[model samples]
Target: MTPHQAEQVSFDNTELDKFAAYRSDGATPDAPDILDLSNNELMLPPLPAVAESLHRSGLRVNLYPDPAARFLKANLARHFGAEPAETVVGPGSGGVLQQLLLVLAGRGDEVLYAWPGFDAYPLLVAVTGATGVPVPLTATGEHDLPELLGRVTSRTRAVILCSPHNPTGRRIPRDTLREFLAALPPRVAAIVDQAYMEFDEEEDPHDLGLIREYPNVVLLRTFSKAYGLAGLRVGYAFASAEIALRARKTVIPFSVTHSGEQAAVTSLAQGEELARRLAHVRRLRADLHADLGAQGLTPIPSSANFVWLPLGGESDRFAEAALRAGVLVRSYSGDGVRISVGTEEAHRRVLIAAKEFLSV
Candidate 1:
């Protein structure tokens, strides 16, 4: 008898084919020497204490990390004024988001979020076997709360809101966000992705009032952007104990390494240093925005560590020009470009590119 043919592999081929890898701003193939402003990372080194923690943890690399990440969770809880049971830690905020999606959504359920927001939202939602629905941002790059509310249906399982939204750096006002949450159905979870929260100096980064008032609301934070811990891959979330527990269950064992936990905990203790870093970032962001404006390029008013240039069809061209000028920025094809705040020298190079590109 002829050997039976292998059965076709089971997979979501369509979704897998459509998926694009997350692109971060860094040394590009054409311009390895370019100053990287593609990723919205703090252009600074880690805190002295954090670095020391990393050094100390080097000797412990041979040991397995705490699978529950108890110490990191406790530190985050203490820093954010939440109970340890109400927090979850993971490899990064992106990882924590994946955990939440897996716990709260599944096949046939729908996850809604603003388009051109965090690039990972759709990918993460898709991995959970949920349908990803994207609503467009307003012309000014702010969330259209009414539009998002109108799109919610019975099948909608979760909504991801990004403050100081990525690629645009526009924040949803506190009152506006509160109203949006109030209008959302309690059954549908609201995930407030506050990855850039610390950069908004005007806001109390540790405030958990929203989660307290609305048990369905979850806050996502990361040490990647503000803490200069991108390489460490530490992120966390705060939610109602029920949701937090469920999400925690989805975490892969020991995904957060020992070094990340120690570094993050140490960084949390450097409140004054964090404040100084925030002030410097805010100042640099302002200078970059103003300088771009002087070059006749209208960048969106940013409340985060990056600025958005609504270059529309010219986005790619501008990015190319910046690359040629020795600076790397993130371009969204026909939409716009996001330039992270960098050193004065890097900003000068970007400005040179901006002036040349506009004059052409």
Candidate 2:
């Protein structure tokens, strides 16, 4: 084909417009007076030991990271009590999730997940050339398991379940999840998105026995939220050896940076420090929930480090009010607004704006 033909091919723009680009709160401009709680990022600095590890790793910028992130994989295997072959590491949970989808799904396949959950799910599934089938959450903002299972067909490649679900903040109880898994078809893989599992202080976050029970399960996790390593972007997953191997084959080489890998390794060693941060986040979440309730708003109780208000048509209005108060929060259009558990000043600002909005 001639160069002119190649340029003309780009003119079609058919597949290019299949979906919208993935947007994130990280794009919000940083300002001295602004408190951006739009993104569910830990507002605290990195832990002492984690900070030191990153500092040392920074000195070797001239070298390339381990393409497969062998050390990080080994550490994760030990931390989560799995064999190295059972692990898949990538730049972030989203990145790792994409890796899994690239292997498990493709053109003509359908991936099912809850709507008003992760904004990126459909976009991520689209990248694999698969259609994203959204199962709407219940009126109470919880997943309807039977409804989801009923949507599955012979072409269904995977079903994603997010516990401590995003934006809505409701978690799937272990027994409930186990029951769902039991009913799911054997050929279909179940990807359990556990990005916020660390903030779930009331349950056993370290449990890996679920994978043993369901070999098709893929537990996706990240160092972003509670570990304060969002900037570094280290994520991993635990799956059966066969599934993990396929996911690993899809990993983008060197996507996990050296500094990110080391920081994750160091963070894994500080269980006590991690616990302290988790407890602090839980306190902030509860306080924020109660405070919002006091303002006559119904904020869903969260197992994650954020509170979700199902404002219906007021979602955008409430988010606008928060921005006017110099606090940025996420608005899911007519669904709700998600306010990350930020510092005291941020929450204070949110409360004032909320009360002001209610009074009007």
Candidate 2 backbone collisions, by pair? none
Candidate 2: list runs displaced more than 4 Å.
1-16, 24-31
Displacement of residue 61 (Cα, Å) in model 2 is 0.8
The models' CA-based lDDT, in order, is: 0.90, 0.90
TM-score of each: 0.96, 0.96
The per-residue C-alpha lDDT of model 1 at residue 32 equals 57
Q: List the candidate 1 regions with Cα displacement exceeding 4 Å.
A: 1-4, 24-31
Worst 10 residues of 2 by lDDT: 8-17
> For candidate 2, lDDT tens digit of each residue in 1-360?
988877753443333257678883333735679899988999999999998998899999899999999999999998878999999999899999999999999888899999898888988898888888999999888998999999999999999999889978889999999999999988899999999988886567569988999998999999998898999989999999999999999989989999999999999999999889898989988999999999899988888999999999998899878877889999899899999999999999999889878988
Q: Candidate 2's error at 343, in angstroms?
A: 0.2
Q: Given candidate 2, what's the lDDT at residue 206?
A: 68
